[model samples]
Target chain A: MNRMSSENNLDKPKEDEIVRIDFAFRKELAEKVEGNLASFCYQCGACVGDCPATFYSDDFNPREIMLKVLYGLEKELIGEDSVLWLCTNCYNCTERCPQDVKPVEVIISLKNMLADRGIVPKTVSRIIDTFEKTGRTVQLSSAVTKERAKLGLKPLEEIPMDEIHKLLAPAEEDSGK
Target chain B: MNKFAFFPGCMIPARYPHMEYAIRKTLPNLGIELEDLPEASCCPDPIYFKSKDKLSWLSIAARNLCLAEDKGLDIVTNCSGCTATLSEARHLLEDEELRTKVNKRLARIDREYKGEVRVRHIVTVVRDVAGYEAVKESVKCKLEGLKVAIHYGCHLLKPSKIMNVDDPNDPKVMEALITALGATPVRHRNWFLCCGKACQDEDIPANMMRDILSTVRDVEADILCLICPTCFSQFDHGQVRVGKRFGEDFNTPPVYYFQLLALAQGIQYENLGFNRQRIKPKILDKIETTLSHA
Candidate 1:
């Protein structure tokens, strides 16, 4: 449990832990990402035009996320209300971006940054919990197994459940640690 | 002989042993050697990406890569998530500042990567290293007339530049390998669609299953060829639940890309973990029939 406590402490920003915003952080982060030619973006809305997710839902706007990053709106860009989660990571926006701004990569970078800060949504946490419990993220409940048999499908042989439990025992212990 | 540092992500050893059996049996015939990396940890998928801890994720992945580099062989992965994460980390480590930051955190583990090794997905190795002609020559049994729908899972091709094996939208290498196995590659619209595995948490599994079932039905193919373990598990296992949810009978064919290759090489179904799958299509009999006729 000491390790978990330490991890929790590390995630919490101290009074002086604020990263001084400079052009260098943005430049370095941008350079580390692939296919993001942010300098080429001239605010042409070609990316907005091709984003299917954006048109269907205001929750996912690649154009706005890109604009925020380019304008150095670090707080607003990485804020909790940002719609970065809605991205399907489909690369559709990257393909259609006329200026090669690569909103897809930028959004991924933002997500990665947030994850570092330990702000992952509860839904994602459950999945990781299941993955940690069972080696597989998607576990078929017993009812689902019966339904499978009703359809004339064979029941999936459990992969040595006890053995798998042992294999995954370490991850659970480590997570707790 | 091409010797590769093997990275079998968690799923292959525990759930999908068929993929492991196929790779173990086939790679040797192709003159590719897979050296076991025993201490290799979980690719820490779904969590690493969802957690978005760049330092921890990169550091952990770099530790795995550094293990391979220590062996002085190129790192090869059968899992798409492992390939994507490792490749992304490899690219990030190329920057001196990023490497220093990542390595400093990883200093606890006493691991640092010098960016000397290459991370290759099994599909990339088969297409690039083995070549179509070599695959054709190794086929003891050809899968003639077996219709297959190739599903290049999202992680393999997305952020297309890092994994620039082929065009993400119009990938053909998997199809070419299927063709070399003497099978017919079926084209479908949802070929480019995400298995929705990435968003399985957001949507109900039943909804995601329905989406997957609809995609399989739309293709109307005999079997769906998958290059990823996550997609394989989703399509093969998820289809059953999806059918029950929709109150419709949908028995879509699902097989790994290497499983098809192993079958083409005459590996038996039981050994390839076929019996462990939820859905066992009549297509296995068809494959036997086709092989006997040849």
Candidate 2:
């Protein structure tokens, strides 16, 4: 539980074992964003019990993700493992955690950090840009428009790109901070 | 009850326009009118957008809610995902610092989050606002013993603190709506599982969906009563793809609860697009049987 000073370096650590500790990021996440709940996680495996996605992959434990945050294993989590995408954001884990460790909220902060570094999955990266372009994850085509006509519904309108760009500018700046 | 805006989100209008048609055609008969939610974006897509940028996700969802606030109408979203996102946004913005941060961003567009309006999923509007009995009375015919397994997709009932949409585990909203249609809402094992709508990797969601669909099979459900468009597609279409991939038979049909409501309220069978469904839903035949019985 002791904070090792030599473990702070980014790449291949000064230690023989890669401890994967980025205490600064951990502090920022715990204090500024998802709260100190990540630090409070005792890894009781309650999150694994609550995760419906666990059936598909054993590695997709919300508790493990919290452990990553606690250990500041950003590379092991966000870089090596694609477990973040596997989280359905179902909230069952966060909702049921006894320590009030909201793994889903903490997971998002992890995703935001990964996204800030442009290290997210291609599809996730694409959709984030897609929303900026069209204000929709999927765009409306003429065929769908005609189908809308058949359904007696009007064409679905999107928020203008300029407005979306303007709205995101401040956050993009803040994410930099 | 008669006037409110609709938040179709992305999925329904994109892949399932007919669901909106069904709701539009049905809700009015139940005394609810849906107006278009002007200049709305993805709810900005709950899982994906929120994951990428939490602050912007909240700001954007709050902005979407502001449109409804300006119109002085509670927003009713068609997709559970949108309902979850908007609801979470509404809850998060209650914090003064978060509201200040989001409002500062919104100010450029001459929009601000006053949090005056509410966001209700269409199911809540039906069961809570329209009242279950009002809907039940509107059903002049029974579904002729068609048994439905209710799938309350994750967003509608999770992070229950932020999303007061339903009780997470003991949700009776969808079942109550299903019972009103004269179909038996079959309770099954894993009734509280997700359809993995947020799992982007097809394999994980496919396998997860297979488990839920298998439960539907185990209970011998005639069809799934689905509210979320993502869940609807996953059950109806994703089942086929996943089943094919896994070499398992996930043949359970998914019917949007709205379609059943519209059908029970006497919308013609051919008009609602049962043919488009992979499992070929027969809510119409059940209706036909009930009409003959009557």
Candidate 3:
């Protein structure tokens, strides 16, 4: 069954079929993340039923990512800028999964694994850098600050950068999986 | 009735201070007190930060929680992402093992998340803390006949067991608030869908937002009513980009739910920050007209 699944994955099973099974990868995810329903997913396809992203773009499929994780397609899951980034983390999949497959957490775990390997997307990394440097991922706009003053509200004081940097510095060095 | 440490997160404070003005101005009137969470950082970009470093993400979020815990108040976040990160991080750290690990890392910063704070979204605060009836009674300007298409935004009502904000699939919290303000909460297709904030750091497909805005238009709704600032930006600020990207002309402006509440509570529109928007919602004008008539 394992070898057949691997072959199916190699053939790139269309849609929500079991393309492969990566037992080790599934276990690693289970151990690290909140819940790994990756291996346990029966490919019920119920997740795609309400997935808001799939309704917009065919490329954004939650179940397909689940199949990739089950097939041990680590590279497909995280090694590249794959469809995992398209996850809205809306929890639609996790909510309706009959097998208790909380796919959102698995996707987040895969991201953590990828980030630890330093395969961070430029956008994700830049946001991480911004949060580290200024304590706020997006800076408060001067226009909004000026508007606050116009509204008789005090303008926001700048976030203390040193404290945020100090708090986040420990994990910055840890590339641990 | 209950005090909450205000967790504004990054987006609302930076991109939409008018939300703060409304929240600050309106909550006090309703007898809900909010204090600033000093030394607070971002909810650290809940989705993006997790993709970068889960440990750091949880720790940073936990540290924010600790600040509120020190204040002896549960947190009330105005942004959905902030509420998600802080609430979810607090939820995850409830695990003794995970708490220890995150705290061991937090030891470097001389902070520890004791998991003492209860995280509440701004809507939840309004409904539960302020009492929905108090909201109804406090409405000085009844925005009657305004059709509000609400986007609960994913984080506000997802992962039901964790978020526990409302019924996940069929949410009435935001709808109830809208109705209380004398507006009709029009049920539209995919009204509760994700705003695609997770995917937008790349090419935000115009079709994605196109589907949403088109539905709002189909309903002939006046504006998109929501609480999440990220979703607010994607719908309001990203309106033009989503229009240009998808080549659709979308003029619907996104208003923070609290700002709307402030308006109903009688805060001036100028005080709520509608001026900062790219595409302003028609409800603003309608409310102004209502006020001028009264």
Candidate 4:
């Protein structure tokens, strides 16, 4: 009985607990956007301390996102329902990270990866479509024109859509994320 | 008067034209001439556009910058989001490779990012270019005894390497600007928390607004003063939404910084569009009456 307590005890690893680092995804993110910034994170969680998203949402954490980036877990980050959309783009993490990791930049780049796959929230997609069509995200309607006139301000000028269209053109035929 | 290519961005000119009115009314008194950058689009939007495609974001921002360079003038933006986008674009384009890539896109429209002109937020223009003393000199009826809680929204001061507008951790520019206007600047407990307007999820922004408004209430400030239109919308219109959800009366009146400046400069209360705001600024009415007698 005593032998089972002392001699039979051994440290063992769980199968599901082990996370494999996806170097290919990590290398892709590094090359496409941030350029080796996520690799510096030591997971001090300084970014998590100031992040409002983390404070409010149970799921959104910049430190965890950075850890996933470090582990190259692309499946968890780039998706339509991924928690990356909750970022708020406040840049608090960019200011607080001791590693100069710029976690917000990495998060944005990940969102870019999602966008590359045409996975975006409806609200974001609508804003992009509006901007693509009229140059401004908020359209200039008769009401806006009337409001400007009421203030004695000049009417809003029309954007040169011809030029804006040229600028909004996609960079290449097959630019992969 | 120093000339600037006034970039109104999307929000102010479209949604809050009165903020634009206050800006136009006050800037001339401080010796700033606003030259409109015609045919300028959105700073394409600081967040979603950039997140979707960084290259497209840089190209659109550079295109706006070119409009200013054409007139041989620097840009002065009223919206913080616009300032961030343009500032980040200017900062990133300094890399020759990135500049060439962005410029390659710009060439399709017959424009180039020469990196000639700089982008300046209106707050910086007021504090640094015009000087705080000049701001004081322009105040005809001082806002004495009026307590203003300043909200320095995220885009104005964060990612310090790109923004460089102020010390992000301990920003004193907004407080100093408030002091120069003869108003008491109340540093509330939650001064650093963002208004959370840009967060996509509805609940997150709702919760963040509750935290912000509660602190402003605790301090008993007469008005919540901020420079960004996006933050102004959150506190003004979004304040109403938060009150209904939280089942509490958070009727803190928010005034855009320039509107407060316009009031102190003796612009008539009736003309400043206070009546249109969601939360009526009853405290401003008291100050307006006092100024009328003074």
What i-RMS does each candidate reach, in Å? 8.1, 1.9, 2.5, 1.8
Give the higher-DockQ candidate: 3 or 4.
4
lDDT of each residue in A12-130, candidate 4, tens digit only? 54677578999888876775545468889999999998899999999999999989998988889987699998988889999988889989888878877888799999988888888
> What residue runs in model 2 are displaced by over 4 Å at the alpha carbon?
A1-21, A28-36, A171-177, B283-294
Q: CA RMSD for every model? A: 11.3, 4.5, 4.5, 2.9
**lDDT by residue for model 3 over B151-257, one digit each (tens)?**
88888888888899888878889889999999888878868667887874345345667788999888888888888888888887678887887677767878888
Ranking of all predicted structures according to DockQ, beginning with the best and ending with the worst = 4, 2, 3, 1
Better of 1 and 4 by TM-score: 4
| Ordering by TM-score | 4, 2, 3, 1
Per-residue lDDT of A1-177 in model 1, one digit per residue for the tens?
Answer: 253577556565556755454575466456433424555667777777756456446566777777666665667756565566666555667767766576766776777666546666777767666645554445656655554444343444433234323322223222223
Docking class of 1: incorrect
Per-residue lDDT of A134 in model 1: 53
Model 2 TM-score, all chains together: 0.91
**Interface RMSD after interface superposition, model 4:** 1.8
Using DockQ, give the best candidate's number.
4
Q: Write the per-residue lDDT of candidate 4 for residues B35-65, one digit (tens) a residue.
A: 9998799997877778787778888899999
CAPRI band of model 2?
medium
After the best TM-score superposition of candidate 2, give how far the Cα of residue A151 lies from its true spot, in angstroms: 2.5
Ranking by lDDT: 4, 2, 3, 1
Candidate 1 per-residue C-alpha lDDT over B150-206 given as tens digits, one digit per residue, 9 for 90 to 100: 778777886677777788778888889899998889877667766655542434435
Best by lDDT: 4
Chain A TM-scores for all candidates read 0.59, 0.77, 0.71, 0.83
Q: CA lDDT of B256 in candidate 2?
A: 89
- Please provide, for model 2 over A58-99, each residue's C-alpha lDDT reduced to its tens digit, 9 standing for 90 to 100: 767787778778888766676634678788877888778998
